[model samples]
Every structure is written in structure tokens, then in C-alpha cells.
Target: MVAERTSRYNFTPGPVPFVVSGGEGVFLHTTDGRKVLDGAGGAIVANIGYGRPEIAEAAKQALTGMGYVAPLWPTENRLRLIERILDRWVPAAAGEAGLTRCFLVSGGSESVDTAMRVARQYQVAKGRTERWRVAGRATSYHGATIATLSVANHDRRRQPFGPMLADHPKIDPISTEAAIKDLEAANPETLAAVILEPIVGSSGAALISESDYWSTVRQFCTDHDILLIADEVMTAYGRTGTRMGFEHFGPAPDVLVGGKGLGGGYAAIGAVLAKEFVAEALAEVGDSIMFFTFSGLEVSVAIADRVLQILEDEDLVNRAAKMGAVLRARLEEEFADHPHVGDIRGLGLMQGLELVKDREAGTTFGGALTPAIIGEAFKRDCWIYPAGSARVPDGMMFGPAFIISESEIDQLVSITRESIDAAVAGLQS
Candidate 1:
């Protein structure tokens, strides 16, 4: 069995949990002959589903051609991907040019690094040496890099690296007035950029601020000459129903960072999109952003191109909106009255549920509640994304593939209900 074959490479020589041999649509085929429903779409990625032959063909075609062009040179796939994103995916609300500059990288961390550095560079190019800090939301998360972790405020992820990270100022997560106060306290002149997720994901379980908060923050950043950046790493490319998360409200951001769903789980690709002015500011000073060695790999670019086209051709973005409503209704039906379920939040296909000790008291059951609930789901051949950290410590996210059906959504929610109950019961005992 392929499951047994994995033991040969375990180093320690032991049987492990079931290994995924393949995936199709909404399910992962395990080596143990189990069809595990991928409720979280592999860490809330996977937009169009898996085992796409078209993506493989696009990648193979690119690989057969000139495979390793230096990122500085614009290859065919690289050019095509940029055109597609700017013309189709970048939100129209961003104006005529609509985030005119696109920078590609290998993955999310690199993308965040590129964005943060670009923001800093833009400031330096404009002779704003005093503008060195980037203000982030109190509960927001950017990525894995030390620089990103420093700008972000996930308490658990930042705990170990506290000594190394520069202390970036943090603003109130949901209140415009409090956020303004935080910004004033941070000394606005020191801020180069303000980075945040339009809809908080992993660290806050799809949390969204009051609608006015985004617009107010945008104006605040503008008034202070601070570049406002929307970190769309998890909410871009139709994951949140709209083409982008910021579309829910607010004027266009100066910079937008994207990842995960950009390649639809087909390739390791990420992007940073900047408004024309931001690029012009750096270019006027003859400064150029650094590129990673593997930035915009032709194979990855080709695969991402196909994924975007697939989303457009099949109208999957709209499907996400309709299916998101279905998902929310299903979750409400199953968990609204459950004692341990505290709150439901999210948009499009990226919904989340918060777990608490008692809904009436709003008391938390701290410690390993998320992992325990996840373990229960896994036992029944389902996989849900574990989410929440810091202030909101126990929550889970349901970000299934855009192509997921009503039946699949029902099954996934049912499994969630069973899993939550089983875990809660075990905790009670």
C-alpha cells in the first residue's frame, strides 16, 4: 500500500497518520482508502479544487520552454500573469489603473517581505527618513517572516521572537476613534505604512471591523502621509466572494498583498500590487525593489494563470458568494443554539465559528480547545482549518473550495457539529 510505502522514508521508521495520495473536487483521497472531506481546503487555500489536468498541462508547457529566466526579465508567462491580474482580478474600485504595479514572489512570507520593504523604500525614496514604522492592528497577522511578525500582533507567534522584532505600534482592531487615538499615540510622523487585513483570518477567525473603520483608517493614513496597505494574502482572488476583501468598503489602498488563493493551491505563488503613485515615488529616485532568485518561476506563473482563467470562465467568484450564504445558513442551523458556540463570523466561503465555555457568560475555555475539536473532526474523516489566536483564542474556519456543492457543505457542517459536541462532551467529562 502507498500508506505502507511512506514508512520507508519516515527516518524514524514508524507508521504515521494517513497520507493523502490524491485529491479531487472537495475530498482528499488518503492512502488508507479514506475519502476525507477537505472542509478547510488545505489551510483555507484551494479555490477551484485539486487534480486539475489543465494546470499540469500549463506547467508542463512552460517547463518545456525556457524554464529558468531571471526574474528581472519579463518572460511570457510572467507578463501574461501580470496582465491578467491587473486587468481582471485587481478591484475596479481602485480606479482606472487599479494597482498598476505587480510584483511576484514564491510565497506569502516573501510577498509580505516584499510589500513591507517596498513600503519602507517608497518612504526613503521620497526622503521621509523619519517615517520608519508601520502600524498594524492589535490582532492582525501578516506572515512568517520576522519582519512581518514584527509588524503583526499575534501574541503566540510573536512570543518567541519578541527580542528580535522591532516594536511596531498597534491600533485598536475595530474602533475608528480608538484607532485614531492609537495612531496619535504612536506619533504619526514615524509611520511609513499602516498594514492590516480587511477581514481578519487565522489570528482572529474572520473578524471584520465596523464598516466605517476602514474608511476612517484610510483617510487617517492619507492625512498623515502614511501608505495604507491591505494585506490580502488570505482574502484575495475571490476567496471572500468579491474579487478582493477591501471591496466590502473603503477607498482603494496604496498597496495590496496577496497569496494562497492566487494560485488556487496549484502553485506556490504570491503577489504585491501597488498603486501607480507608490511605484512612481520609488522610481523617481531610481530605486528598484529586490527580487528573490525563484521569483515568478515560469511553471508557477503558468499554473496561476490557468487558475485565474478557470475562476473567470466558470464564474466561480459568484459561486463563492452564493455558496457563502449557504455555508453561513448551514452553520447557523447547526451551531446557533449549541451551548459552547459563541459567535459566527466571516464572508463568502471563508466563514468561522468561535468556541466558548458558555454563550451566556461569554467565558472562554482556554488552552487546547481548537486542537481538541480538530482532532475530533479528523477522527471522522473530515478536515477543518484551525484558526484564532491571541485575544480570540479558540475558533475554527470553514473555507472550502469555491466549487463545493450544497450537499458537501451540509456534510461538512454536520461533521463540524458532531466534532464540536464530541470534543465539548470530552471536556465536560
Candidate 2:
């Protein structure tokens, strides 16, 4: 029955996984009575954990008070969420002339698409209508939308949409000199923006470029008048300990994209924020952004505002930083010597565990290792997010809720180790 129902709605063809009945705190309850720890926070969402009664109350009030409103208009919840992000969350954390404007959308893809459009629009508003290209790193995942897919270079995801995607110039992900050369070759006058992730998530398994690289890129973007956009969908709002992932390094991007954590898995909401000058240029032209009808749903904004308030009142951001240290220590202590585990790297709670055929030989088993390992982990009552691209072959992301306890961390690590071993044994046999 569970298999039939799951297969009916989901697009994926599969032997159905167990039905998730409910979730509380850091654990998910199965319909069959199996309780599993949430290791990946439901695709790296769930900052405040699960089953919070406060979220329910907030949702009820929002729907009962004033239901639906158009995107352009401002209601109490919309105003509150905008004020919260502008005044408390992003203002200071964003670079010198901080972000002064934001647009709310449904999810990561929409948020990314909005940023891409704004970049193009910014150029058009400034009379640089010829600049339409948005450069991005060779291996990155902004979102699933067509425009975002065109800007990013995740091979597998873009395979089917090759002909439809715009051929934006690409740059090296790590090398500063190569990246600079690539930028110059892209022809500054024709490029409008450059999109990047603070730490490469799915495409590179939380890859962190040196601080110098980010600083250099910032200067290069500034020199060329190309806006730098940071896609923080998977690393913002307490996931990276800091408010924004870029805070770990130097200056902030001209445009910042965020989602998932904003609503803490309670609502589907995303935001694309821009520096003051970018918005002013568009406003000066008396131009505006096109809004998606469900841009800022009354219920969603209410839930998101309530969620951010909870994150603040409970000090979960600081807790994420503190607990992230403990999670890192546990991962290091456990997987440092494991052969299948090649590397462990990340900031705050968003850590990536790399997989290899053999760590000593620096060999990889391509992308096959990830699914095998993930399958094993699921059997052990843990679900971790599989992370990789065609370029970055195999790995998994471990992003639990900020409220996760030390003992829960222990179980997660232990289960992961055992799952890796089991998968390896199965492969050998």
C-alpha cells in the first residue's frame, strides 16, 4: 500500500522507501514504527528541528487573519519578514554598502532565477544592454530552473537541457590565476554577472576555495563591473554558523540568493537580495521586477517570520556554530583513517564526506559509491544527502538540525561508518 501510494505521486521509478509518518526534533517516525535520526535535515533544511507547535499556531493565525495577497502589496507578515531580513539578518553581514533590497520567491530555483534576471535587468537599466552573459564556476548547482541551470555548470543536470541553455562562459573553481584569465577571456563588456557559492555544495561536496581566491574574485568582478552573486541556498541562516556563508571569508556578493533555511522546513520561501546601488539603478529607471503570483504567500511569510524569530530567541545560530564544532570533531575522529572515506570538509553544520575506491591510492569509484553508501545508511535508519556532480564524482552531505544533541551526533557518525563498511563489504563480495 505504501509502495503503491508513493509510486503514484512521485516521479521517480523505484522500490519504494518506507513511508514517513511524522517527525519530531531530530528524528523521523516511520509508519511501520521504525524511528530514524534525521542526518541531512530533509535535504539540508530543518534548522529549528521538527514538530514545533509554534509553527502550527503561526500558520493558523496567518490563514485565518488574512489569506492571500498579491506579491507587490505589503501585508503585516510580508513587512515583518522583509524588515527582519533587512534590519537584522543581512544588513551588517553583507559587505560595506550592505544589501538594501530583497525579493521573495517560492524556492531555491525561483530565487536563483530571480537573481539571474536582476543581473541582466541591472545591466539593461544602466544602458549596458549588450551585457547579457552571467559567468559561473565550472562545477556548481544554483537551482533546477532553466535559467539557473544555464548559469550553472552541473553536467548531469544540464544534459537534457543542453540546446536550450545559454552558453555562459565558465571559470575555474579553485585556481585564482586561471579564473582571472577566464574572466578576462569572457570579455568584460559582454558579461553582466558572475554567480558563485560560498562553499560548493552538491557540485563539489562543500569545497572551500582559499580566502585569497574569494577576495581576488571580488576585486576582479568589481573591476569589470560584473555583479558577483552568492548562491547560499544550502548554507545560509545558521547552516554555516554565520548568518551568510560568505561571512567566513571577505566581502559579500553584489546579489545573494537564499532559501530552505528561511522557513526552516515549515514553509517554502526563498529570497534574492541585492546591494543598494543595484536596486537604485533599477528604481531610477522607474523599472521593477516581475513577481510570481505566489511570491510572498501570506502563510509562508508568517511562518518564515515566526521561524526567524525562533532562531533568534533560541540563539540557534550560535548553537549551530558550537554544535558544528562537535560534529566536526566526531567526523574527524571516526573517518580520518577509513579507506572509503577520502576527505571530510565543510564549515559549520554542512560537512561533506567524500568517497573513494581507496583513500591511500587517491582513487575514486566514480559516482557509484554514493548511492551504495546512501542505501546502506538508510538501512541503518539514517538518511544523508548524496552530493556530487559528473565532475565531482562521489560524496555525501551531513547537515542535521541545529538542535541536534551530542549523543545523536555519535549515533549518526557510528551509523555512517558502519554503513560505509557494509557497502564496501557488499561490493567486495
| Alpha carbon RMSD to native, model 1 | 2.2
lDDT of 2: 0.89
Write the residue-wise lDDT of candidate 2 on 187-292 in tens digits.
Answer: 9899999988989998888888766878899998899888999899998887989988888877889999899999999999999899999999999999888989
* Model 2, TM vs. native: 0.97
Give the worst 10-residue stretch by lDDT in candidate 1: 8-17
> For candidate 1, lDDT tens digit of each residue in 1-429?
644776767776532357889999999998779999999889888999988899989988999947688998998899999999998898777856458999999888888889889889998998989888999999988988899999998888888998999988999998889998999999998999999899989888888888799999999988988999999989999988999899987788999989899998989999999999999999999999899999998999999999999999999999999999999999998888989888899999999988898888878878467878888998889999888787788999999999999999999999999998898888889
Tally clashes: model 2. 0
Candidate 1 lDDT for residue 221? 88
lDDT of each: 0.89, 0.89
Cα shift from native, residue 333, model 2 (Å): 0.7
Displacement of residue 223 (Cα, Å) in model 1 is 0.8
Which ranges of candidate 2 are over 4 A from the true structure?
A: 91-96
